[model samples]
Target: MQGTLKDAREVAVKKLSRGLSQGAKVFMNKAMLLSCVQHKNVVNLHGYCTASICQKGGQRMLWTP
Candidate 1:
């Protein structure tokens, strides 16, 4: 998904797949690695969120935007 931040910066949001056995681990690893990266050629890891929403069949989402 694409969105505009409060500061008017455009960002692309990526939501990791839910319900996979290794989803949490993969999310953490990817977030960590991206956080450490600092290259102009690479898209920045602005932020991430992990949430469990009971309404959506207890959907667990990991979003990086």
Candidate 2:
């Protein structure tokens, strides 16, 4: 998905596939990879995050903010 931040900077956002996602641990890995690559003409990566919710009875809820 694409969006514009409050600063008016355009960005492209990739939604992690819930079926294949691995929460924050993996998210940080991907972000690290993105941060390591550099190119004069390529866009720079900002960061990433993982959000989740746990309910009573040990139910797990996953979501993105």
Candidate 3:
């Protein structure tokens, strides 16, 4: 999805599927790369989040974002 920051800069937000091991691995790899790795074509990653909300059943996600 698209979003606008406080500075009025437009940006993209990506939330990958929750059920795949490959997706989780990709998320970790992206998170590991700091903004210092600069390139004209590569966009900088702003942030990410992972949450596990409890439920009566075993609905908790053991890992991944």
Better of 1 and 2 by TM-score: 1
Clashing pairs in 2: none
After superposing candidate 3 on the true structure, give the runs of residues whose Cα lies further than 4 Å from its correct spot: 5-9, 22-26, 34-36, 53-65
Candidate 1 achieves a global lDDT of 0.64
Comparison by lDDT, 2 against 3, better one: 2
TM-score of 1: 0.63
C-alpha lDDT score of every prediction, in listed order:
0.64, 0.53, 0.49
Q: In candidate 2, what residue range of length 10 has the lowest lDDT sum?
A: 56-65
- Candidates 1 and 2 compared by lDDT, better number: 1
- Cand. 2 TM to true fold: 0.56
Q: lDDT winner among the candidates?
A: 1
C-alpha RMSD for every candidate: 3.6, 6.9, 7.3
Scanning candidate 3 in windows of ten residues, the lowest lDDT window is: 56-65
Clashing pairs in 3: none
Please estimate how well model 3 matches the true structure, expressed as its whole-model Cα lDDT. 0.49
